[model samples]
Target: MKRGLLFPTTLLLLLLLGTIHAQPTPDPLDGGDYAQVYARAQAGGDAVTASRAAAAMTEYRAGGRDWTARAVQAARQATTTRPGDPDAQLALGSALGLQARAGGYTLGALNTAQQARAALDRALSLAPDRPDIQAVLAEWHAGAWAKAGIFSGGNQDRARTLATAAARRAPDTLFVQAHAGIALSLIHDSQARATLTRAATLNADTPLERDLQTQAKRVLEGLKP
Candidate 1:
């Protein structure tokens, strides 16, 4: 009786241990689900879906730079799959710009920034009337000007023109307003504070718009007197 009880107890313990050992570890990068969505969009040849997925991936700020890199990869794939799609090009440019900002002035970051500028220029050429693209391009030019100066070909005047154009094109879009605010702030324009304040108070229609609003608020808080 005792021997039989011991065998049963040992078997139960071994089974429990096996179950514990078989449990899967949680993924740290699980926040990158947008990559899978982008893959599906690619498989379906849906440029709109691909662009949305790329934008969604960029919104995953909790995942940090790794997540942003995934956004860049997804955006790049979208652009490659739909070379003529303005939205795809815009998504790529946005992701690259975010990555460049996060990485700062490293050589790799500078290279990525150049790629972002090219992508944004392509998007602007494809859809000259797109306010979001114009605003983003304005911010890009302003950022370049702030970082590298006019001798390096960065143009604050061009940034201001693009920002003004974007604001005129889409006065109601939070994305455009926020980016325009950023461009103006980079040049230390007096209107930056008012634009950023207005952008922060605007209603966000989508998750991306909400993120832009949040960014605007942060910039507003950081502005110097």
Candidate 2:
């Protein structure tokens, strides 16, 4: 896809920030104020729920204010409870990235920007062999580059590289392929169209996978000639 055919930065921000909102039917897991429950799950010392919820929160890239804060809290708690788990780190990094994007130019955005990068760097280091981690990190880099540019540690080339690597590693995984396509399309990679097409054809086994497919299809539409 040509750079000129891409949407302007403002529009790109809206989409990448997940404001497009043209989602499919509400899934059981995504509906309601589940974020609150997820946030409070760890408060009673339920480390298992905290870990699972943190991973769940990382699935959806964006959300409303209170929901996002709660999700971030859940992820943070997960990290505190399971510091050795790469999933916990991925959750923290990915959620912080969303918080930063939603923060716009706020002072806290700067804080989250740094924390997000550090958290994701740690995640990849902890589990370099995991394609799921690679895909999530790919989206983080793409979004960081789009929102904060190179100064904030967002490298388009790195995003593309990780996305491609993830696709190669987990070609059958729904989120992996979808995120790979999303990251590639964000950087205007030539293979984005094919990757997204592959994602669109995948059988989404979970609500989150269905949601990811929706994002993939949306980006595929945008990338079409």
lDDT of each: 0.79, 0.76
lDDT of each residue in 1-225, candidate 1, tens digit only:
999999999999999999999997532223345677667766787655565565566564454676676667767777887888888888888888888878876888888888998999999999999888999899989988898886334589989999988887777777788999999899887878888887998887555566668889998999999
lDDT of 1 at 173: 73
Candidate that scores best on lDDT: 1
* Candidate 2 Cα outliers beyond 4 Å, as residue runs: 1-63
- Candidate 2 versus truth, CA RMSD in Å, comes to 17.4
List residue ranges in candidate 1 displaced over 4 A: 1-60, 205-207
Candidate 2 contains a number of clashing pairs equal to: 0
Q: What is the lDDT of residue 178 in candidate 2?
A: 91
Q: Point to the candidate with the largest TM-score.
A: 2
Clashing pairs in 2: none
